[model samples]
Target: MQARQDATARAVENADNLARVIEHDITYTSQLTDLSIQAAVDGAQDADVMRLPDHLRRELLFDRSATASQYIGSLLCLDSRGKIIVDSTSVVPRSVNLADRTWFTVHRDNPKLGLFVSRPLQSRLNPGEVDLMFSRRVNHPDGSFAGVVVAAFRLDYFQNLLSGVKLGPGGNITLLQDDGHVILRYPNDGTPVDENFSGRKNFERFRQTHETSFLGTSGKDGKERLYNFRRFDKLKMIVIIAPAARYVFADWTSRAWYIGIVTALLIVGMLFAAQLLSVEFRHRLVVEQQLRDMTRIDGLTGLSNRRSLDDRLMLEWHRAKRSGKPLALLFVDIDRFKRYNDTYGHQAGDDALTAVAQAIARNSQRPGDIAARFGGEEFVVVLPETDGAAAAVVAAAIHAAVRGLAIEHNGSEHGVITVSIGVACTDTEEVTDALGLIKVADQAVYRAKASGRNQTSMAEPFGGAAVTT
Candidate 1:
């Protein structure tokens, strides 16, 4: 009896650990794909972006995809009319209209929806290939609906990610959205991906806890199994690991028949299995740490990426709104950056960008402050509980730091690397949401650039005149 109990406990522990590892991997992939989509949304906001030459527009909207090509199948920007405006895979937009698609209609009808993950479906661009889309709503400066930015992930990529796990005999792994729709299942059981399991007793029990292990009967195969499941904190997804109960106790059952003769051998075998599990668990912990770092940090500048910035912005926005405090944003752009890149090589341009990023990071020293590389030649700083006056001071400090670098850029009128900064604060009623604050700040940057390239500009109330600092 004791041996059977030990076997069952080990199986449960293994399943729980494996489920955690798989959950972290899936979450990281989803966030990375969403980041790419957000970048496209940001680029799409420029009304003239779609009018640029095809290659130039594609590079601006889809440059992030190059870093994550293994997971993202394609990045696309669709117009408000649901016509393909920009596609990452080709220079010319495809003749595809997604106006009738559910994903498109959901964002069009709901302006507040942030990111939406869709069920697997056949790809219109790549016939016969299945894709799962990660999408975000794009909005015009006045907060009107613009379009949708999509990152399509090939289903086979997920299959390969989960296929390496050695779930023992009759074991299975399932990935489901929070709504109980199955996204993927291991062993390719021929079950449809969209099958709804929310009505099942097993799924209801799994949803009862954030992380847990139990023994249950498989709804599909009708076999008793040890089930371990976990749900993500912020992501709308759950992971389940189940291995047949008979297989879990097979060794213990055999040992019980010969307890008098092979008792010592059984003890040694159990110890060996326990040691293997410990090693595997430690290895997975290391992998999870690496994945977490990759998801939050930008590869080029070593600062918080757009994904991290978006999360922190929303968090601070809500906190300030509740506390009746102010939040500030700075839009910093390198002056004459394209001219610098044309004069020097791309390597020199990269060095200049890194130097400018460091300058911005130095001035944003508060605990609640964050500086992130928004995209090429641009950066954003979030200052929680800060007013317009204080934000302008920080922007001035950033301008000074960049001048201190003294990086020579003969392409500029100033003969040195300089930055144009746009500052905006949520002290006025004009800014209703986090995205609105960003728009105001971005507009201020444009004003700064237009007035002259090397000064600070503060945003007036939305639609009001620009204020020079």
Candidate 2:
């Protein structure tokens, strides 16, 4: 239940954020449209019809895709007769008749309309792509209404805005006008373009209320969802962030499975103690514990095995992301381990490896931290909520602990055996995958060896400098 609540809270927060973004984009595009209109009016003041100066034309024609506010794909100046005078997209403007377009006709019919946003449609310049035109009435210098100034905003703009959002499998986010036209839907191959949802219960409820959030079933798929919406009054649109109910309850299901497993273990233990009460029961308990441990424990070092590390890393990664914390990994390798095995024989090498593993286990004191043997003279320590600095300190302590063993090594630079430690950490925002952390830590270990063994090094997140000790 707690897991379900957490998921819902996260979904609500994410929805709120997405709503703000959509609202802001609407306002931004509206402002840009107004600015474009003013520029057109200024440029056309003394023209035979509506002519733009060379500089003004170039400014409007400038490619905005490379810049931050490149949402506007193209701009155009039109005459009162709805004839294209200047197209910002081309050096030599092409003649396109816009007199029949809704945005053009609407502004042409009504001179009082300040800014009009049209429904999604294919662009005149690029017929393959869908676009929305934000247009405003352009009045002639003599006060009569000239043609409309149009700012064509590609639908790709909205797609880019919502691309970074992560809705788990089967989840979806959508942008819809209050009139029930679907502007965009993610995981769609542009098939839902201008889809009318006016008759859908969810759309009707969304339009009828001024609420920011709603819980309902999707009319399209019958999947129950928690929908959070923000209305863009200027654009007459709403951005809906919805995650499927099943996805939201996934964590709760995982928790229930864990609870069931623990209950079964408790029942088994109780039955053995109450009924079979003797030496046999005690022996059975030990055997059962050993059998359970075998799957996740290293037989030689008595430390957690690679399988345990993988599971713990996954769990800790999720916890760190949810808690907005950091997770650190220490990849420790015995320096010149192969040479030591060759010189000291396999038995002595094994003893040294066991001692090093014990030191690492002792140093990772936190209940949430895990120490595991990652196969053949390599071990890993996982520290949840620990940053790079703290992990470095732990790395230094592990170095000292292992050095205290004083296991002789003739092949190593140092007289006594030492281990190279590589530390890597990821903050909540940077948590893309758990495997990335391991790869980074492994690279850091390689750096430690390159710089001279018996040292501690930290891998910088996202290819930054490596800090060494």
Instruction: Name the top lDDT candidate.
Output: 1
The TM-score between candidate 1 and the true structure equals 0.53
lDDT of 1 at 78: 88
lDDT of every predicted structure (CA atoms): 0.86, 0.80
Q: Per-residue error at 424 for model 1, in Å? A: 99
Worst 10 residues of 2 by lDDT: 60-69
In model 1, which regions exceed 4 Å deviation? 208-211, 260-469
Q: Write the per-residue lDDT of candidate 2 for residues 184-296, one digit (tens) a residue.
A: 99867454689887887877776677556667887777888888877777778877878887777787778878997999999989987776677787899899999989988
- For candidate 2, give the lDDT of residue 309: 90
- Lowest-scoring 10 consecutive residues by lDDT in candidate 1? 460-469
Candidate 2 C-alpha error for residue 203, in Å: 1.2
Measured by TM-score, how close is model 2 to the native structure? 0.50
- lDDT score for candidate 2 against the true structure: 0.80
Best-performing candidate as measured by TM-score: 1
TM-score of every candidate: 0.53, 0.50
- Backbone clash count, each prediction separately: 0, 0
